[model samples]
Structures are given as structure tokens and as C-alpha cells.
Target: MTDPTPGRALPLEGVLVVACEQAVAAPLATRHLADLGARVIKVERTGRGDFARDYDTVVHGLSSHFVWLNRSKESVSADLKDPDQLARVRDLIAGADVFVQNFAPGAAERLGLGADDLRRDHPGLIHCSISGYGSTGPYRDAKAYDLLIQAEAGLVSVTGTEDHPAKAGIPAADIGAGMYAFSGILAALYDRERTGEGTTFEVSLFDALSEWMGFPLQYAAGSGHAPVRAGTSHPAIAPYGAFAAGDGVEVVFGIQNEREWERFCEVVLDDPGVATDERFASGSARVENRPALHGAIDAVLAGLTGDELVERLERAGVANARRRTLDEVLTHPQHEQRGRFVEVDSSAGPVRTLLPPITFDDGRTPRMGPIPDVGPGV
Candidate 1:
């Protein structure tokens, strides 16, 4: 196996990606390509560049989102409305393996950078478009921010507590769409290798997020009842939520089947009779009697410290985890031990980000490359 380090050739070392991307979704798609060693030329507005650059100044005067997504990219200033600069961007796309954009519904066509326009000129170029909704839907022209897509896709409906709906802390809609775009581009590239021709594809934030809402959607459709918002608890599963110990340390646990239920009763509760109790005999029974079940479990857990409870749960072969805050997760021991974090150079300074989740055959990570200035290609 080849060494999967910075000095060694990466999978996409020879590929070129030209991206006319501003916000999270399209930038995330191209960023993954850059992570695999593709040469990504990011085309931005002439002056202030990607508006996301102004989202915040949390990272030593740079936006954290921009720093996280724009690494290993060469940024070029462009004015699509100006013919000269538009031609420059076109020149970049002419030599690219992939061209990606997330312009509004009809903006690409107006700028002569639409998929059909580019593919007709360069038949071998893979073109991808990301938008709020799809091209043909009534909501196609509607603006779709991350939270807006989450609500429209039914994610907000199922998320958070029973009394209130909440969007995810992270940009789930943007992430879902970006991942779809990334995978779609990979599939298209593989096909192009065989056909010696490229194709065009589209990913919408609404579509991608809706696709991810599959399990809830299927459940609601089949049962004719929407899942109740259970906060930290599972809507369908029993004994699968956060519970606090005597010392107030919260631990989340789950009981999947009869065997696990029996073991949880005997090992964690120290009362095997509780398993066969009529109200808790089966998974459905336990869910129905969740109040009593929680009372019983809480009674047992209240006597033990969180660490002791976790140890006992491990011995019982129960799936469990300590409830951690975002800060705790940031400095999580597993991530640190696994060497999952790496420092990359940014316009502001060095910033740390997680390495791509996949590991190469050589058991090494990708090169953590630098973020670009507003006009690196100037």
C-alpha cells in the first residue's frame, strides 16, 4: 500500500474542481474533494468574497465556517456580470474535471454557466448544481436557509421536546445536501472514467434533508401517527434515554431486545423479577409503561454514582454513554487518542479541524492543507 501521508500522491491528486460556491452546502461538497487532493479553485465575488466570510469573526478575525470549509482551495475573484471576469472563470472551468455551483434557480443560466451551457462546450466536464429546492418544484425559487430547509423537510417537526420545536445546533440541511453532492460527484467521476464523458446532477437542500427524514416519514406513513417529540428519549424504544445518577452525572442507555431487557434488570437493577413484570415484559409493554419503567430504573440508578453505573452497565453488556456537553465533546478523549484532529493554516492563523473520517489503506490521514486568502489566484 502507498503511504497515505502528505508527501505521497492522494486519490484525487490530478483532478481539478472549479467551484462557484458561496455558502455551506456547495462549499462543503467541494471541500471534501479538496480533502482528497483535488485542485479546487474557489470563485468568489470580487470584493468581500463569499458572504459566509462575514458570518462571524470567531476565529481570530476569520469566520469559523469559512475556515472549516475553504481549506486546500485556491480562491479567485470573479464578477459573473462582468464579461471579462466571467470569461476568466469560464477559462478555469474549461480545464476542470468538475464544475460546481449553488447559485439561485436561474442564476447559472443567466451567467452562461449552467450545466447545459458548460457541458455543451466541454463534453467531458462533470457539472453539479445545488439549490434550496429542486429545479422543477413550486418551491424551487424560494430561499432555503439551513433552518428553513430543516422545517420544510419535516426535521424540525420531529426534533426537540414535545412542547417546542428546535432546529439542530449544526447545519444539518446544508450538511445532508453537501454529502449527497459529494457522493454524487464521486459516482459521476467513476462513470466518466468508464464512458469518457461527463454528466450533470442536481442536489437540493430540501430533497437531501427530506431523504434523511426517511425513518420518521416511513413510521408516520405506515402507522398514521407522527412520532412524538421525546427530547433525549427514543420515540419507539423503551429504556433508551438519559437518566441521572445520585451524583447528578447523566448517562444515556438503551435496552434493545428481550435478552438485553432481562440482563438490564438482573445486572443493573439487581432484580431479574422486574424483567418479567407484566407491564415491562416486552419492548412495547416497556414503552407503554415508560413512566413506571423510568421510575424503577431511576430507583436503581439513584443509589450509584455515574461512573459506577457506567461500569455496571458495561458488565451487563448494555449500550450506554455518558452525556457530554459540546465542550466536553470537543476535547473528547477518544478523538484525541485517535489523532482525529489536525491543525491547518488559515488566513487568520492556524486552526484545528477534524480529519476526514475515512482512513486510507496505509492507515494514514490526508494532508491538512491551508485555507486560501480572498484572491489567491489574483
Candidate 2:
């Protein structure tokens, strides 16, 4: 890997990561490591490479998913079943500080890339495995796609409207697993630095997303029923969702306390009496009578244009936002003003991407290296 600019080293500058990663989860973790300047060598299948590379050709004829997750890494294409190819991958990992993989449950063991075997030889190598369920659950062998894991982990149960429960537009389960793996690897690296011994850990999509479902899970266990699925709205909070203005533009806002609610009624609704009405007085009362409360809100909002309503909410000191489409988000003023977008090289061409979220106070930027094209077998 090329050296970072002198005197502006990234956090993982000297770290080396070898990743036998295919889809979203493992790729995301290694990509983050790459962002921090770790030299990530991604191992892929010989012919088609990562299957996600074919998910959709939306980004300059490159798969959007692959472009989103595989930036700043070197890819080595090899058929692991071949002795020489597998030996080459083993050699790469033998010198790596970190090794990550997300093969099918038993596939890694069959290929002799299992954590036990690798750790036995490289005692100081941090090994991470990501999977759909876990290594030893009844569902371990089950097919665990992102949507299936979302449904299984109760995320889909609490998402969308009551009549039409829906999975999140993004792959939440996969992302959750990826983030956990990323964090786990970081922690293990820290531990290795202190103790001179590496760590082996596993993260599963089902477990990761299940941890993310803490609120709804606890609510169900405590209240004896699942929270209602209210699309773009909260089940327990009032005045907390999208409302259309006279011009048909949607404005989303929320009231967090009695003070905000009173201000919202007086300024935005232009009716202070609505805040004291018995049907909508307290938080519980408003939630219980949400239909009536929304009706009253709609009546007032219908008389105001989107700009007028937003101005009123601002005057009332209530937090609010305009509902934006995907294209609008790409050019959002906040992102532009903050200089959050950057162009990176890819096989197709240069593509615009957002800078990594973590920022250094000293103005040091994360590595924004080129996306890799699959290379010939080692």
C-alpha cells in the first residue's frame, strides 16, 4: 500500500487486514478499516468476484452496492479450491494483523481458514467472523438474508404502518452486524496491543439487530403487546410525524415536552385552546386520542403553506424539517456547506462519495483511496 502523506498519518496506518469477504457485512467492516488507512487486501472468487458487484449497475456502470462498500481496498481474485490459490491467501493472512471473513457457517472450516486454525499459528492475529445467525444456534444453518433477519429479529414487526409491516429500505441487519464486527475488531486490536495476544470473535446479523431492537423488545416484554407500527410517526409521541401544508408539501416536526406542545398549539396551530383540551391535554391523552389530535392539527396546517408552517414552528422554537427526496439529500445544503462530499476513483471512473463520518479535531482526513478492480490470482 502507498504511504499516506507525510506528517498526517491515519489511525490504522501500519495495520494490515486480509479479508475473505463477499457481501455487505464483512466488506463494510474491512472498508472502514481501509478508511482509517489499514492496508486491506480483499480476497474474492476467481471469475465473478463478489456477487454484490452485480447487484445493480447504477454508479457509472459499476454496481452501486459494490461501489458503496468496497472502496479503498486491493482485491485479489482466486479460486480457493485450488491448492496454489488457497496457499497464496493463507500466506497473505499469515502476514496480516487482522483477518475477517463471512463465509457460510461451515465453509471457512472446510477451507481451513477457521479462526482456531489461523489463531493457532498466528497467535497475535485478530480474527473476526460474521454470519447470519451464530456458530451454534438452532438457526445457525438456516438461510439468513437481511430481510429474513429483520423479520426474525422483530425489526420488521415494529416498522411501517400497522396494516402493512415493512422492512427498512436499507439493509439494517447487515449494517448492524457490520458495525459490530468493526467495533469488535477495533477492541481486539487494542487488547492485542496491550496483552501481546490476539482475539477471535464472532458477530451475527440476528444477534446484532436483535440488540438494536432493545426498545421495542423491552416494551413488548413489559407491556404484554408489541408497539403499534406507525409509519413516519411514533407510537407513543404526538405531533411527531409528517404533516402536509396547504401547498401539499410535507413538513415533519415533533413536540418533546409540554412546553413544546403548548408552543406548537399556540404558534403553529394558531389555537392555544387545543393544548388544554381534555382529549389532548397530557402526553398519554394525546397518544390515546391521536386520531382527533391529528385531525385538529390537519385542520390548522391545511390553511398554511409549507413555508408559513415552517416559519411558525421556528418562531415557536419547535424543531422541524422538510421532507426531502433522495436526490435532494444528495445535494443537501448542510452536507455541501460542511464539505462532506468528495470524489473517489473507481474502475468505471471518478464517483462522488461522502467523507467518512469520523473526523479528527486536528483536520486530518481519513484515507479516500481508489476502489479496486479484481486482479489476477496471486
Candidate 3:
């Protein structure tokens, strides 16, 4: 019998993608494609498959990262080094609208599946190449992981507490590169419909993250100095970031302009005179006296429980939030109210997850189906 509630399909139906890939960058790009209704065939090495499969066994014996990124893909094992297998891979591309890969530099060319090689014949194909650095650069061949790129991109230097610089908890560089690849492929597909000519696209983690560094780059350019690492705190803004509340729950808030500062003094802190204090009069002044200002705000906030204080901040028009643990976030009321949970099949079993951030007019949310094993019929 059918369940009481039927499942919704993702948005990319009818599109076919042959992803000759591995790791987070490629799989993340293809997973989104699958989410949007594309038929994504993940081509893995014949024996071992994506190395990520062995990244962990936390999720009932599957890598949580792989599970998160590889859902809904159809696993297809084919050795690119094997001539017959490579021919089969090409056959897949011949029938597919898009081909994606993050193979090492010159690796794709050796296999005769490089973007240039594919474009010569499959003029209508949208070929996307994802890489660590880029096709051509001094660091083109330099190895890149999320942490390494963070340092190379100068992200790590400006992240974390002043005592220690740390990498991002997530693979932001990889995700950024994958997103660019996905969009490039989409734009290429759109272009082929008009010009009937295939286009090759390339995304480098360095460039991808460089775009993300725009703000800090501009900041440094204008100030003639890079921002100092502040951990979870906003580098420029004062009285922002986390602070402990009375109930032992931490709440976060920031003071912006004189208006907000005055309001903060009059309302939440209930010390109207503090706004006129020379130290707290302006944003820069407050930043200059951050330790004292933060101490004052912390003292006031610590007198109230997490919820009560959040209410106070909300009433005063200050942005505030309850620090939520991962477990708490999974059942957050806003997501539940918006009906974001979705069920998808997996090799291990069925699993549920949240929908993408984007919403559409058709009242349909993108679906993440099942997680596929590294090898077919495994």
C-alpha cells in the first residue's frame, strides 16, 4: 500500500548527466543536478569507486559527507584506464547532454576525455571541468584541499579566534567550485539550445574562492591592512557574535549605528546614558572599546535567560538568535513549518533530509532521493 503522504520530485527531470568524478566537488555538483531531476550516472573506478566512500562509516556504515552529496545518483563502475571501459564512458557522453569531471590536470587528456577533446566532437555537449587551482597557473598542479585552499586563499589567516586561526568547518572552497561548475554547465546548456554549439567550462577553487574574498580584498585594499582573525566574531562590527545568557544558553547580537546603539541603551540594556558615553557613541568608537562594550552587553544579557533576552532584543529591533546545536536545528520550527523535510532512497535504507534553500512557484521543492553505493549492484 502507498504511504499516507506521497513524495515530491525534484526539478531537473529529463536532463541526463554523466559524471566521471570523485570527491566532494564533483559529487556535490552532480548531486544538485540529480536534485533538480537530472538522470545522473556517477562513473566510478571499477574496483574501489570514489575514495570518499571510505571517508568514514559514521552514518550506519557510510560516509556522512558522501551521503550528503551523493544522493539520487545512479552508480556506474567503469575504469577510465581500460580502453574498452573508456569507450563505454565515451558512449555515455555521446548520449548525455553534459559531462563533468575533476580529474587531475592532463589526466582527462590522457584518457581522451578532456574538455577540449570532448568539445571537438560533441559540439552540443556541455563539458565542465572542476579543478584545484586552474588549467594554467603556477599553482595549477599544486595540490588543494579545503584547508590548503583556505590558507592559500588567505581565508585561514582571517578566520577563527585571535589566539588561533582555523579552517572553515565545511569545505567551502570545494562547494564554491562545484556551484560554479553547475552554473557554467547550465549556462552552456542554455547556450547550445540557441547556437547549437557545445561549450567547455572550467572552474578553479582558487578563482572560486577569490571571488568569495572580494569583501576582505576590498577591505584590505581600502584600509591597507588585512582584517585580524576574530573567530566567530565579525571583524569590523562591535558587540556582535556569541555571548552567554542567564539560562546558560548563548545569544548573539550586534550594535550597528548610533540609532541602534541609542535604542540598545534605552531598551534592552535600559541604560540610556550608555549610548551617550564617549566610548559607545559611534561604531568605530565602540569597536575601539569593544572589550568594555562587550562586557557591558554580556553583563546585561547574562541577567536574562536565552528566550527572554532574545525576546528583549527582538522587541528592540536588534538581530538576535538562540545558538542552536545541530540536533536542535534538525527539528527547527521554521523549517518544519515550511515543510522542508524530504525522504530519499539509499543503498543502506531510506533517509530524510532538508530541501535546498531555493523555492519555486510551482509549489515544488527540490528533492534529494536515495544515496547510491560506489559500485553498481554492490
- Give the candidate number with the greatest TM-score: 2
Question: What tens digits encode model 2's per-residue C-alpha lDDT throughout 163-195?
Answer: 999999999999999999999999998999899
**20-69 per-residue lDDT for model 1 (tens digits):** 99989999999999888788999999889999999999988989899888
What TM-score does prediction 3 earn? 0.94
Error of 3 at 37 (Å): 1.2
Query: How close is every model to the real structure, measured as TM-score?
Result: 0.96, 0.98, 0.94
lDDT of 3 at 268: 90
* Model 3 alpha-carbon drift over 4 Å, by segment: 1-11
Off by over 4 Å in 2: 1-5
RMSD of each: 2.0, 1.3, 2.7
Off by over 4 Å in 1: 1-8, 376-378
lDDT of 3 by residue, 1-378 (tens): 012123555545678999988888888888878777788999998777889988999877788888888887889898676788889889889888899999998899999998778878887888888999989989989998888998899888778888898888899899999888888878887888799888888898889988999999999999999887876678788878888888899887877767887888888988899888899788888888989988888888778888888787888899888788999899999988988877777767766776766666766656556787766521
Which candidate number maximizes lDDT?
2
Model-by-model lDDT, in order? 0.90, 0.92, 0.82
Model 1 TM-score on a 0 to 1 scale? 0.96
Q: Give candidate 2's error at residue 302 in angstroms.
A: 0.9
